[model samples]
Target chain A: MRNTIGEVAKKFNLNISTLRYYDKEGLIPNLEKNESGIRIFDEEAVSALIAIECLKKSGMSIKDIKTFIDWCQEGDETLKERLEMFLARREALQSQIKELESTLNYIEYKVEYYTKAVTDGTEKMVKETMSNPRLLNLQ
Target chain B: MRNTIGEVAKKFNLNISTLRYYDKEGLIPNLEKNESGIRIFDEEAVSALIAIECLKKSGMSIKDIKTFIDWCQEGDETLKERLEMFLARREALQSQIKELESTLNYIEYKVEYYTKAVTDGTEKMVKETMSNPRLLNLQ
Candidate 1:
């Protein structure tokens, strides 16, 4: 059985318009349309949609996603290329994770600083004595 | 001495237009202007800019950032609010980091699968035997 675009969007927590736009952009390879021109999302289409969402969340641009999808359609001839792409994606995600960790550390420092200030009814003493130099330099 | 907006933008790796827009939106509290109305970024203004970038990176909306900056200008009266805001940001960053880690794992699985496929020069056997249920389920 196949799902309609609306059913798939609801299941995936994605906007109906976004799915339509993705179809319009030809981002979903081999996506089907019924006689009435409504989308018929099969298992393969759903799999492509999931990969699109994952790649997007990993910061791949729409244009790059199109290239990646095209490569997928080319079969094992592009296996090496796909491997290199995933390795690049891995590097990008690692840097992003590191950046978020640093930001989290900064926020944690602020939380501690504010906790003390809220208790003391003033931040003068806390500001004078407490400092996270790495966080301080980041800002 | 104060820095020009251009100098500050280059130092922070931010766009000059973005800085001007932030100033226009009053997102940077106490940002100074010279006799000709050009921005004069003082140490405090630079500090505010850094916080703005950090909060933006943490996924805070510009509207929410403006409110946070306003709270900062309100002195110790907003201490509790600032603490709560940072706590919320901490939670957000933690979740984002976790999501990226999950995506990274999925990509690493794909990398290994593709590497083996490239070595065999065909994915038939490898695709049949090697499966990552989590990655497959994600798609």
Candidate 2:
């Protein structure tokens, strides 16, 4: 249930340097040191790393993740504040998703218009653009 | 109008090195050269940089953006293929948006659970966890 950093890196397909970077950033807590002064990780450490990866892929910054982990270690006393922080992050992500969706919709519309123009000929495309002032002078 | 790299960098709030980097990466094409071999950017170049910023924020890689620029320069002959590529990119972005949305939902759920636990006291929280067999073991 315990392993060296190298072992965990190999198992998780992460570079050893990334693990070291995370540790330096305070993203990992309760990291133990072996008799040889090497970092030792137990099952709980592995679970924490997995959680860190999840938060990272969800777009959480290392600083914010460090704060979240600190709250986790502090137990139920800080849970309400942690919950508010999590909800704020979730709302931010929701807005980001909405913005991306809107941009994607515009890109899709442009692609469709261009596709039709290429298939039906440039003359028709010009006429369509002329009829729709919004599509005028597209570069 | 024309501006030196330094002037452009100052006006745009970007570093001179970043402009050089963009030029080296082929993100900016056909940059005019002065008699002394210094780069000179016109209004169109500035507009292109703004467009590049828009695409970059939308998560498009510089290489893909270069290809898009190439297609734009080539005109209607490459229009169909360009449209197809844009459509494919749009789909990929839509999928990413969906993944972010799901992650946001999960975070929201966790936030609610933690908020209730923190407000209701740890004893009540432990009692609630007792309903779950895995958490019951901690009791």
Candidate 3:
């Protein structure tokens, strides 16, 4: 099943401009083109796009993603550097998860405080209970 | 000791313009000023700024943060609405954390793939071991 760039973009709910931009940015290198200059997304090209989505969601910048693509194109010699990059980004993502988990804890406090306030038809209980973090520590 | 906006901004490694923007946005509603109009941030004001930092880092928008602040100032009457807002954002944060965690998993796979590739001095080894997702499931 051959897929055109427009077809792949539609399937992924991505804008055509975004796919074109990714192609220009080297995130989609080795993209095949027909004699008529139509973009062709083979299985390998689709896999690359999926990898790009994973990296982008994990907060990698366009420049960094391009570096990764360059490494892939350059082949076996860059494996060590690629491993180092993955390990570094793994730590960054871990820290991000920790930060968001803590924010969840904070938001839990607000939810509890407001729930109590709504129950009493006033915020007095919430204010009185404010100093105690454990009151909202549902976990 | 009383602190100026610049001092507080420097403490947090934030730009002076950011603090001014927060003030203009009403995130710091009761900021005091000296006789000559130099903004003086007391301990309480500093705490407010810290709270703002927490919310901002958790992906809250300027408009939403302003709504939260307005709720605080509007007293007990806004408790229910505040509760709804907190619940909505709590769900949003939960989704964000889930997304990040999945990204971490994807990165873990990459790290494992590259680690083996580097050890074998070839990308062929990386490609062979790609089938079992559980092999790199560090979590």
Instruction: Indicate which candidate wins on lDDT.
Output: 1
Evaluate candidate 3 and give its CAPRI docking class based on DockQ: medium
Instruction: Decide which is better by TM-score, 1 or 3.
Output: 1
Candidate 1's C-alpha runs over 4 A off are A134-139, B135-139
Candidate 2: docking tier: acceptable
Best by TM-score: 1
Model 3 spans > 4 angstroms off: A132-139, B132-139
Could you tell me the TM-score of chain B in model 2?
0.72
lDDT of 1 by residue, B24-137 (tens): 899877878878998898978877877888898899999999999999889999999999999999999999999999888888887888888999998887889887655444
- Candidate 3 chain A worst ten-residue window by lDDT: A130-139
Deviation (Å) of A3 in candidate 2? 5.1
Q: What are the per-residue Cα lDDT tens digits for candidate 2 across B37-99? A: 999998767766765765665688988888877776777788787778777877778788877
Model 3: per-residue Cα lDDT over B1-139, one tens digit each: 5988788888777899998888888888788998998999997677677667667767989888899888888988888788888888888998999888888888888898887888899989669767646323221
- Would you list the clashing residue pairs of candidate 3? none
lDDT of 3 by residue, A61-125 (tens): 98998899899999898888899999999999998888888777877877887888899889876
Give the per-residue Cα lDDT of candidate 2 at B22: 89
